[model samples]
Every structure is written in C-alpha cells, then in structure tokens.
Target: MTDRREWPLYEVFVRGKRGLNHVHVGSLHAADSTMALRNARDVYTRRNEGVSIWVVPAAAITASSPDEKDPLFGPSADKVYRHPTFYPIPDDVPHM
Candidate 1:
C-alpha cells in the first residue's frame, strides 16, 4: 500500500514594508495552512529580507492568458485618469 497524499500548491509573497509590494518568493508544499506558513519562513525568510509573508494556493490564481495580454491590458492605457499626469504637481509636493 502507498500513502497517497497530494501536496497543495502555494504561491508565496513577501513584503518588507507597508509601502513595498509583496514579491513572489518560490513554491513549496504543506499539509495545512500552519505548515505552509512555517515552510515559507524556512524557505523565504532565511535572508531576513521580508517583514511579512503570504501563502495562497496556486490553483486559486485566476490570471489572464499571456496570449491575451495586449487585448486585456491595452484598453487601460487609454484611461488617462489612472495616471497623475493631468494634474500639475504642486511645488509643495515632495514626491511626484
């Protein structure tokens, strides 16, 4: 008899601060959420570069296909309101 346990895939993300975006570290396997966190610490935190960690199942990731990348995202390019270029930066503003 064989012990047939399937490991759930996880997507690991780490961030150094609230201002920084979480970056994908690598993938690992765990039996449960607790184990997933511990495994992430063991793998991604070894460098002491991250202040936070997040693990999400890879299967849960719904992403647009690369083949549709242009059609999916290109429309947003015309939405100038998303960019701050319309506003004249005040001299008082530190970072524009």
Candidate 2:
C-alpha cells in the first residue's frame, strides 16, 4: 500500500445540475489524477447532488495572498467605467 504521506493533495470542485459554475467542495489525497477524480466524486457527490466534478493538484494551484490584495486588486477599484451604475434600469427589466 502506498503511504498516505506520499499521496498528492487534490482540491475538489463540483457543479450541480442547477449551478452554472463549479464550486470548491473540499480536498483529498490521491495517488494520481484518475484516483483523485474518483475520490472526489465519491466523497463529494454521494447523494448525487453534483453533475460534474473537477480535481486539481494542490501543488499546481497558484493563489494570491491577502497581504497583496492592495497591489493586485486595488487598481481595478479606480476603474469606475467597469461598473454598470451609469446605465438606467428600465421598469420592464426583470431582476435588474
């Protein structure tokens, strides 16, 4: 049996039938991508709540740190044109 410590960590994402995008569910350890996918399906969708599954190696993911939030995302805050507040919402528009 392979030692648990040697297994690579995987991040699992699942998309439900009604959901338009995949959401992060949890993490697990697996020996390979195939195993990781299978494990994610069994672990996350036992009740068949999900229509799709995605397993990504934890090592392959690059994430921004909270400390770098200002430097990374602050620039976008100044771009007021990016927001749709200037547009008038018609009374006929539903859910606007």
Candidate 3:
C-alpha cells in the first residue's frame, strides 16, 4: 500500500560564506527529516552560495503579520539605548 498523506512542508535557511545569520531561502515538501535536509541542500545551495543549511518545519515557525506590527514590535521603539548609536564603530571593523 502507498502512503497517501501529504508530505510535510519545510522552510529552508541558508547561511552564506560571509553571513552571520541564517536567511530564509525557500520551502519544500518532504517525507522525512533526512529527505528534507537533502532536498533543501539541492534546492537552495545549487550555486554554492551558502556555507550552511537549516531546515525547519513550516508549522514550527511563529511569525508576526504586518497588521500586528505595532503591537508586536512597538515596545522596542521606546528603548532608545538598544539602538547602538551611542557607540562609535571602529573604521577597521569588516562589513560593519
């Protein structure tokens, strides 16, 4: 008997060579975790633009919608100290 259930959807993240963070690249449907990883690699890193890959189930991510922007991120606006403008960045800092 063939399994008829739909494959789970996975979100793919790729970290470029000089990147400090993993950026969301795309999504794919896979039967299992291993397959998801492999598929993500083939689909997102085909040009070797990424040095690392991450795959997370689409259902696992929690995102705030544009309509909720004020309520979700409004608190940070009042915290001026967190802006990092008080510190002077050294000219030697690469990619800063």
Best candidate per lDDT, number? 2
CA displacement after TM-score superposition, residue 37 of candidate 1 (Å): 0.7
* Tens-place lDDT digits, model 1, residues 11-85: 898886653788998888888778898899999988787898899988889988999989889899889898878
Q: Which is the leading candidate under TM-score?
A: 2
Better lDDT candidate (1, 2): 2
Error of 1 at 20 (Å): 4.3
Q: Return whichever of 1 and 3 wins on lDDT.
A: 3
Q: TM-score of each candidate?
A: 0.72, 0.79, 0.69
What global local distance difference test value does model 1 have?
0.86
Instruction: Mark the 10 consecutive residues where model 2 has the least summed lDDT.
Output: 1-10
Q: What tens-digit string does per-residue lDDT give for candidate 2 at 1-96?
A: 865566889999999999999999999999999999999988999998899999999999999999999999999998999888899999999985
Give the RMSD in angstroms, all C-alphas superposed, for model 3: 3.8
Evaluate residue 20 in candidate 2 and report its C-alpha lDDT on the 0 to 100 scale.
Answer: 99
Candidate 1, superposed: residue stretches over 4 Å from native: 1-6, 17-21, 76-82, 86-88
Which ten residues in a row are the worst by lDDT in model 1? 11-20
Whole-structure CA lDDT of model 2: 0.93
